[model samples]
Target: MDYSKLLSKTVVDLKPSGIRKFFDMLSGLDDVVALTVGQPDFATPWHVRETGIISLERGYTYYTSNAGTVPLRRELSAYMKRRFGLSYDPMTEITVTVGGSEAIDLAIRAIIEPGDEVIIPEPSFVCYEPITRLCGGVPVPVATLPENDFKLTAAQLSAAITPRTKLLVLPYPNNPTGAIMTAEELLPLCDVLKNTGVAVLSDEIYSELTYGVRHTSIAALPGMAERCIVVNGFSKAYAMTGWRLGFVCAPPEITKQMLKIHQYAIMCAPTTSQLAAVEALKNGDGDIEMMRAEYDRRRKYIVEELDRIGLPCFEPKGAFYVFPYVGAFGMSSETFCERLLNEGRVAIVPGTAFGKGGEGYARISYAYSVKHITEAIERIEKFLKTL
Candidate 1:
């Protein structure tokens, strides 16, 4: 039997994630200073951890409600209202998920049918396109420009649509580019979406990490709430990545459908994580603030250092990553990343890992200690001089 022929075409056609290959090559290589992977270096806050511990000490381990613990859902609803001015009916609009990852997967599976097209802005999160394909949808990647600060314009949206477009993945405070869509930026896209049948899968996991201005959601735009699925989680905000917890809020119709897929695929989110996340929702405001402040400080520092070293990166508005152009060095993004790892012993992901629009760039995450950040930049600067 030919193993290659045995695989499904969808699995065979899928390209492996470019980011993971570089990371795999760098693993256990003792000298590399990595700015790869988008996760906060901070530990989960003590109180949040304590809540999980206390639950375990009392032997509270068991399967939770299919939606999640009622207490957590209630606190999550209140947390959204308090933090983002979005009101969700905990009983009808929310479904707890494994992570923002699972929330994204569930959202696509909930609505897309074969031949449906999912509009994805390039230089955005990688998962959107692959997951869309896995759900039997065709991914239509619209290129977002660095000149536009990587925000997708209304014209782009208008041009990308067709009768089969079932959804758009709105990844703001976005991953590799670190670009965010302001209220002004989003409103016109909302207008473009106004009468269309397409739904928006808004990933707002980075919403709480913005500096200076608040993050805006497409769901918050007038007339969008009913047509949007908002995915957020405690991973970035509360440093709970390993805990694997997240939630999605949408109109009851969509949520009801999403719940069916989630219920079958995940059963429920983690019980211990749900209990601790309740504490996070109730009292983690200070922890969010502290982490945001630290990221901002590093954000400013890295931008300055990169400029000082002649990299000239755009100052990222939100999230913990910086994307700097590497075109001047006359190397492909993959070659640059590979050579950087092999020569300078520094790890970063190629921008093309995101999409074609990211060809001449590389993504460096600031989710590490300042000392590590400083050291990484210093080495990067030295590496550039040799180039």
Candidate 2:
């Protein structure tokens, strides 16, 4: 069987996810304290879960319209407006997706064409670059520095833009690094993008998990929404990762085309999940607050612990992960993580898994309970002493 010849060359060439590699390694080990994945440790809010249960009990297991139910869309519309001051027509401008990941893929595919270029800021979530490549679009990675607090600057954005540039992925509050772009920080980049004919995919799945300051969507900025697709979901905020539901909000013209892809590829998001999401949007504010407060506590503890142990972590203001520098140990990010896993029994992802920009750092997720995080920190500290 000549499987190599038969398989899609692009899929064959694409590297397996770096984050998942460490996660998979854990399955063979016992008694290891792992902080590799970024899923919330909290359960889905009881009310939201109850809603899904009720929908199932009522025999609501049927397919929905390709764009999802009208009621769910309306709730999504209201939720966006209430939370971020963004407006989208429920009927024509919003399409529910399998998850924020799917929303990202749809937006990129809907816009990117062969030979186009996507400007991706690295040390980010691992999806953007590979997804762009799968679309036959070239990925241009711009390394966001720790000195800049990992935020992408206007100068960097300007330098990356070319006539071939077709889209820019704005991932914040970011994964792996936990960096965020405040309105003041985003304004300069927005100004640079105003006439560039480049669309923006603003992945804000962590919107409700920020600390000290609220999240500001790039689409909320003046003149930006017209060219931006806002991707968000119930995963982080509502602890609904298993629900497998997310949504995209964009201009009608853009969504009209994205829907065609969704109709053919997905048909619709899960019916039970969509109905449950309606309840989440309408009544899950308190759930978000409770979980976020706990995450904030964990965030502070992890950052302080890393610094105390001489790892020099960047204090993350958003998201649930911290990217701590591991270069002082004179080991590659992968080697550092491998040693931590094998010797310390504490698992974390290497920064190089994200991109070249992540070469000297490693990501530690604070999405676990204080006790779980404390155990991992102790193991890490013990491992550092061996250095």
Candidate 3:
């Protein structure tokens, strides 16, 4: 009769996502200018959607190969090289996953042993540490600071590692903080990583949305191609979140192991999404450019407005979220977000939902319309006046 005793302790102890609770609260409110989740407001590019439509109309709905359609994988390989200078063999080094979340799970489950440590930078995507724990690995969080623009320094990484560190999660163009690692910024960390027998799980889903600087994949660094798994998807850049598609790229040995877990657990990725992904890679660059321009405009406007409202915000260089420090008002991040939603009727995620490093901050997604974001900012200003 005791459910707690019957369930796996790991699953029982895992906390549900903090982002969703705010989303659920906002869903019931009327006239709310909400920006809690990172769901991109842009429509999925027509060409990509049309391909999915055509596939469905033609009844091309059979399951894809365990690794995914060869055509799609080939296009992904080409896209990686074109966008980020990363190289991989489509047939042997990439496996299409249900989404980037699954790729993280597959990568962690494939490599980590029971006591292995997974070094994750705090203020990171929420899934990494949880998935690591579920896979029986220890989650070691290294706090990335606002003073350093939230980028994990070489000293932090050096200190986090031990003989048992099996992996390092590199989530740049990061979700909550929107911090990015440039090639220059990554050099010394790469130096530190070079000596350790650790694999890098690079999450670059926002790679296509960077403003001025192109994203540099750790996989492309010298000797890194052999020791990295790059996890990415159509969710953010292409506004294809509903498609439920993503992929991972690694060396053949790692790919082979991850592919096995993916095969047994997932069988294959969705067929329609696979076909559409091929179209996306081939013809979606223009769409990415258009969306990126709009996001850049909104990103700038939001940062300026937050400062004018007396909330200091970090000018995020990538992704569509801005992290603003909310501690000066003498409230915790959770209380700030809760009060903001109930009083201001504008929903934004608390940064501590990400990790402890996010204690004094709140994450505001700018993926909504400019008018919508502007309105949210106006309401937020009035809320602060009340505080």
Please report, in order, the local distance difference test score of every candidate based on alpha carbons.
Answer: 0.91, 0.93, 0.90
Listing every candidate in turn, what is its Cα RMSD in Å to the true structure after a full C-alpha superposition? 1.0, 0.8, 1.0
Please identify which of the two predictions, 1 or 2, would achieve the higher TM-score against the true structure: 2
In model 2, the clashing pairs are none
N/CA/C clash count, model 1: 0
lDDT of 2 by residue, 1-387 (tens): 999889999889899999888888888999999888789988888888999999999999999999999999999999999999999999999999999989999999999988999999998998998889899999999999999999999999999999999999999999989999999999999999998899999999999989999999999999999999999998888988999999999999999999999999999999999999999998889889999999999989989999999999878999999999999988899999999999999999999998958999999988888899899999999999999
Superposed model 2: Cα runs more than 4 Å off: none
List model 1 lDDT by residue over 286-366, tens digit each. Answer: 999999999999999998998899787888999999999887898898998888888888899999999969988889999
**lDDT value, residue 230 of candidate 3:** 93
TM-score each candidate. 0.98, 0.99, 0.98
Question: Could you give me the TM-score of model 3 versus the true structure?
Answer: 0.98
lDDT for predicted candidate 1 compared with the true structure = 0.91
Global Cα lDDT for candidate 3: 0.90
Local lDDT at 251 for model 3: 91
Which residues of candidate 3, in runs, are more than 4 Å off?
none
